[model samples]
Target: MVNVGIGLAVGALLLFGGWVVTAGLATRSVSAVNAVFLSYVASLGIIGIYVLLARRPITGTQTDLVFALLSGVFLAIGTVSFYGALTRGDMAIVSAIAALYFIVPVVVDVVYFETNLGATNLLGLGLAVVAVVLITV
Candidate 1:
């Protein structure tokens, strides 16, 4: 299993690369929808290559597949919206707003997964919200 700190660092690095590519595409008069499609296609190719290198049998139950599909749908919608915002707004502000999406999963975990949200967690969430508000304003 990957260490959580390493996983998070890798994820952040990959996301930063994505944002740079998207920003470059945005400057080239690419429509947000088209940019999103292109990015997904590129991601698919990279993931395919990784799967090949890993050489593990891909296996999932029907429920897992359905959940994956649903998540993909939501991801597409969110990406399109984010790309659209990037085109029309300041990239820094747009990115700050987009970063706040973490709140959704936190809320979902607390409400549906019954995950405990301790005082520190709630304080961190509140601070994040305030930081974004301050950035946007």
Candidate 2:
């Protein structure tokens, strides 16, 4: 059977990739902060609607809430910075560097979560680095 989780993740990847390109293009006409603020507002409104339609309960433990708050803060900071970079720098270079952020999670998973990467995974990671380098230069 096809893995629904993997399929959804691929869908998310495509969606986010498109979002990056769209944001890069759209932010060209506005200040980075203004663009990011509007982006988040639109996202919040859309997600809020989805939650309401799905009757999704927004409930969590105290720790979960705290983590969620931190996540939001970090996301806002990163998004604003990314938009700023996109507006000020060549989009290809900015995006190549931005894509390297994936390394952080991989490191965290390997170190703290004791997760292991297969040979293929490691090869893919190396290839991604090479791809970014090629893109930037």
Whole-model lDDT per candidate: 0.86, 0.92
Tens digits of lDDT, candidate 2, 1-137: 87999999999999988888988888879899998988899999999999989997879999999999999999999999999999999987998889899999999999999999999989989999999999988
Highest-TM-score candidate: 2
Give a tens-digit lDDT track for model 1, residues 35-127.
Answer: 888888888999999999999985799899899999999988988888888788887788888888889999999999999999999999999
Off by over 4 Å in 2: none
Model 1, residue 134: C-alpha shift (Å) = 1.0
Query: How does residue 105 of candidate 2 score in lDDT?
Result: 95
